[model samples]
Target: MRTPAAALTGVVALAFADASIVALALPAIYGRFDTTIVGVSWVLTGYAVAVAVAAVTLIAVRRWLPTGPLTMGGLALFAAGSTWCGVAGSLGGLLAGRVVQGIGAAALLSGALELLSAHVGRERGRRLWSGAATAGLAVGPALGGALTEAFDWRVIFIAQVPVALLALVVLALSRAPALEPESGEPTTNPLWATAGYVSLFAGLVGALFLGVLLLVEIWRFSPLAAACVMMALPAGTIAAGRLTATAAPAVRVVGGTLALCAGLVGLALLPSASLAWAAAALFLCGAGSGVVARVLSPAAVPTSAPLVRSGGAVVAAKHAGLVLGLVVIAPLLAGSLTSGAEQAVVTGTGVLLDARMPVQEKLSLALSVRDTFAEAPRGAVPDLAAAVDTTNRSEATTAVVKEVDHRLSAVLTRAFRPAFLAAAALALLTVLAAFAVRKTPIGYPRWRAAPTAILAVLVLAGPALVAAEVAGGALDHGRYQETDPCAAPADPYPGDGVDALVQRVAYGALHGAACELGLSRERFLLALAGQPGFAGVEWDPSTVERTVRAAADRALDDVQQRGDLPGWTITLVRAAVRSMPLEELLRVVGLR
Candidate 1:
């Protein structure tokens, strides 16, 4: 790479990084700007929307302008936008800055390509730009998280000012490169390639956007800690570059899509609030997305079409998908999480009431939790230091507090399940598009559509299974309104005896099941215990059928009511619940 191309590459990385760099900083901005997740999201989408519109619309504009002048001007405007964002007093003002930066970024991206092509070969220039952009997307959030932790979120924009200026300085000092004339009538876009970009970026929302929020808001990790965990993304992305180099295009797309889907599924079903689990899942996402981006991006740009117009298609498709993901997924995520948060607190109330603590301590602790939640920012799990604050520390009180917080985190993690799965499904669409550009595995040239059909089903199955469990969106405002026993218990008790813990979980599950059934816990337990073969050595399917219906009817009812679906629509639900190996579960619930 020549000095000018290298300089432009640096800025291209920064500009694309600018797209997602604000992601980790959003939680801080959330409270600071008094915005919800939906509102704060415009900070991200605004830039992307601007970039998408400008990247395409400016194609005609770029045709007339000299690359040298255009790129220098773009660097200056980018600096101006950064300074504006740094100093903005309101979210609206900051958004305006984002728009400015986005337009400038479009110019930068366009001009960078021209300069690179002039200095390096056309093919090499496109490769460098694509790699830098992909790397930028992967690196942005982690770097933003680090910056936000070290200083204020506003400092992030201030920090970019120097980078853009340094790039401008390099370009100024280097030799001016000549712009290449548009050689082909690149009138039309590659449909499959564009679709691939759309699906790929839309799915990435699960990994980059929601993943960071889970770490900072729900897990109560600091921005720096979240950044450290997110480092797995870039590591895996870089690693996948090497791993997929020899793989065929179709294999890269299908395999990458599968990996991406699996990672998201892993996220949806995360076992605990362990950073290791998150990092592992994100690694899969990173590698998968990296493979997809590298293969699909060049495929979108046709060999015959003008590189600028085709580049515009790729840019427009990607950022538009981001905008699309934010528009669709953000609302879904916000709605589900809001109600889920309230439900979590209501569910935790059961643990509080069930603990062996005295009434006075329970009341005191309840009040403290209520106050903390009432004061917490939207979409954030409150720090509950004072939740167990008392003149004297009682073991039962302390235990209950720990369990409730644990439950909150667990439920919050579950709240994101739908969004993650949605993202995975969206990414899966790219595999269908990838088939349009499929090159068989190196040694498997005769592989036909049968394998493609099977791959499609395999890719589609996971999200379909998870989506079957979809209930309605969460309650309004996610506020902990009152005592409710509806959440399912899944976490192991920390430092708890197995027998004692199992007994507690059994009762908790029974209690929640009974609440759904509109029966008292005692009543539900007695009903199961009275059934024939209750606690029997022989598992009786006949009596089990009776017992299963007794317990499952209420659950199916709730599912129907919540989803506004009719009884017959849930035949699968009936089959699944009817087939559950609930003998053990019922026995545990039946324990005295």
Candidate 2:
């Protein structure tokens, strides 16, 4: 009896330990897989979905099966899944393994709880499981992080196998009485409840997770800084968890869920991407999540009997929420942002390229185009260029910045609006789920609640306080901003004099309609020749083109010698010339 009880408790702890443990490992997983925010999130999603599915199914089927055999079978499945995850060659395989492990987790968690509830009185069962589970949850994140940082991420999963096998051994040796099923009105279908929770949570929490990640990644927040912005969630969860356990379980569950919905909607509608706004949403959602977990865990368990099924349903609901959150919400946000950015860039660039504009306007537009690229960092330019050509340096820089900012704002609006609205809807659904919760007696003793409250408060306040301090010193680190080691300001040397002289002749010819303007051998030839020509016919266009290019090259060389400017200026001029037709150069030169 002692062996079985001890083994079950250990198994339950192990199952839940992984949940929080992986939170800190998100960066490591992303690094190894070359995964983006959306893709990497599946590490949690896969596991959760699998657990949800198994939790409900295991509970529903437990009546027809032997309890010990079922528990052992679940453990074996979990072991296999863990092994597969550790050895997985690809991201897909690892995700699959996580799903498999989730199924086992669902069974193990449910079975263990039912066993505890059945062996202990309903009141004692709640107190014991809640106390143990809370402790495990608190320890998981720090322990997992320390281990991963010290050794390797693979060890995190691998470490679970031995402990599980040991639990299986204890279960096999113990002679425990069968956990009786609760006797009352017809039981609510575990599947229906699990599905509802999964859908609702996936839509709400998943969106928040993906949305915040993009804000951090694109906007250039450090991982720690980004995590700070996100800290509101866990804080809320801990605080609410402590407060609501003393209240009616149903009230906490239903009301907390509604709060979650409101929070999600709030996030979606937030006009600015400020950290405070994001944190507020996170706090509301986190509070709701914490409340729901506290409420649901107790409500799902049967006070009378069939502890296994009830426990399973609870675990299932939790994990299902995770799986749905990952698959559904992530893609919606990522796709919307990507599509919006692309469309805005294309439209803005096309408007500037219209042929009917005056020559000076066209020239101004070109300059703006180069400026766009110049203002944006090199890393961002490539993505921006996909919509507009960075082919022109001076004007492209500014144009890209305008286009990028517009696109980002548009996408953020498009994606978040729907996402927030959906969160509101999901919160409403949670309120509806609260109705499904049967009236069970509040189970924990008064003493347990106090400690739970204290711990919860500490957990909730720790990060929030630390983050407030850290954010005080934090730099904005926003998008399209320059970082360290910026390129030195442009230095035009004596060659710049050449470039100026050439420009003078070219402009003079255009302004005065001078044909065959004389080039200054050293200065004018050095500066102006390498540029692209305008569109039209040419009298001896090819000779003029060649002459201009040679002159530009010489000017760039002179600049390099006199002002310490690299030949990159000359190279750029050459590149521009290559793009222009010789006929266009002649036309600009007033030859035809």
Candidate 3:
């Protein structure tokens, strides 16, 4: 009985882990497929959608299905889908494979519990299944990161095939008693459970999805480093589970919801990229989630229904919550990022124009900085210091560069704060849902009821204040001093004919090449000039100008031979260089 139970539990763990294992790898996947963050999210969303649909459908027809065959079939399908995901060439193909994988996951998860219940008692079976699922969630990010770093993101999915197969073989040979039909109506309300699941899981998006992205893209942590930091969440969950085991269901639900709210609010108020602060907040979130899971999981699938149906409902509600969280949070994140970038640009320009350098030198530096901003990858904060030479320069140049870097970093930090606030709103909603739990009324005196009522009011008021702040945009100030600094500049090379044509060709080709290489124009130029054979090459303003002319000449020749470039390529070039500094034209035409 123990061996079969372990095997089935292993299957459950794998299925649960698959739901979030790819989160840390999202940026890598985005770069690989050359797609938008929203588009890459479908990789996660598609799997979740499939799981919700299949779990609900399976629940409606579990009576006609045999547990052994269903479990085996699901395992087999999972293996095939994993193979497809590994080999898929496009984003669409990967998403389709994920859907297939989700379907198999639904069957395996629902059937595994049913098999365990038949072999052991229902109480013991539920404990083992829940433990295994939590363990999987705990280890998923670390495992996914190790796999991705050791090989590639594709390996994370591909490596699961053998594990699923092993589970399949064990289930194929194990014997279990038939599942008895459940009696009586459900004691717990499924609607309330579903609502709670949505709120709780949605609240978790900041810690799991967006948090991972910020670590990798903004904080510049390696995947392995980010995974290590993320372990704080699961660690807290495990500890909280042990401590809350003897608590009443109502106590666990209400306390956990409040803890979650506190954690998200802490995250929103983060001052900087301090790992200690992040870890502490994540620990709170994990502990809260663990406690909430204790009350909510069983409630979602009442014992009155068939075990399979109950399990299916639970699975569907949980994954559906993940989908809901992403849908609401992704757009808010995008909007904040755009607003941040615009603010950064304005602030950076003000710093540049105020520098005490000659107009020509400042203009050259401005053009370089603008190009860097234009070519920065989505969700990445551009490093303005690298684009402009600050060291071994005039005092005024260094001061101005440092100020611009500081302002840009500040803007980026402010942008992500809103996402945390949005997540906090979700956590607050979870707290409200906790009120629906059926608690046994205590026979306390009327005086005690007044204190209890006051505590409840205080709890509700916290979230209300947070929501009011978010709606009122209270935090959106103090970053911008000037809206535009480079509105007009004296042209150093104002002319037409061949010089203009060459400048246009150079800018267009640079933009096109940067797109293809998945790097900013400044980074690409630095890389090109830093090749091994060119180790000792001088990189003064003249040398860089020469390199640009040569690259542009090559591009023009290629375009002339090819006859035309893509329409989008032309559009991208125009947009990129529309606000180019005056020195860029002079540099291109060798006019100093």
Q: For all the candidates, what are their Cα RMSDs to the real structure?
A: 13.9, 12.5, 13.1
Q: Give, for candidate 3, the lowest lDDT window spanning 10 residues.
A: 483-492
Candidate 2 residues lying further than 4 Å off, grouped into runs, are 1-10, 13-31, 34-42, 56-64, 126-152, 169-196, 211-232, 248-251, 265-280, 340-421, 437-582, 585-592
Give the TM-score of each candidate.
0.75, 0.59, 0.72
What is the C-alpha lDDT profile of model 2 across 392-443, one tens digit per residue? Answer: 5446454544554554543444454554555466556666556655454444
Q: Which stretches of candidate 3 lie over 4 Å from their true place?
A: 179-187, 354-364, 374-379, 385-403, 432-436, 440-478, 483-592
What is the C-alpha lDDT profile of model 3 across 169-270, one tens digit per residue?
887787887766656555456678657887887887667877777777766678888888888888877877666644555666787778777767766655
Which residues of candidate 1, in runs, are more than 4 Å off? 179-189, 302-304, 377-379, 385-387, 439-592
lDDT of the structure predicted as candidate 3: 0.70
| Greater-lDDT candidate between 1 and 2 | 1
lDDT of every model, 2 decimals: 0.72, 0.56, 0.70
- Clash pairs, model 1 backbone: 338-478, 339-475
Q: Name the top TM-score candidate.
A: 1
Q: For candidate 1, lDDT tens digit of each residue in 150-171?
A: 9989999999899889888888
User: Which is the leading candidate under lDDT?
Assistant: 1
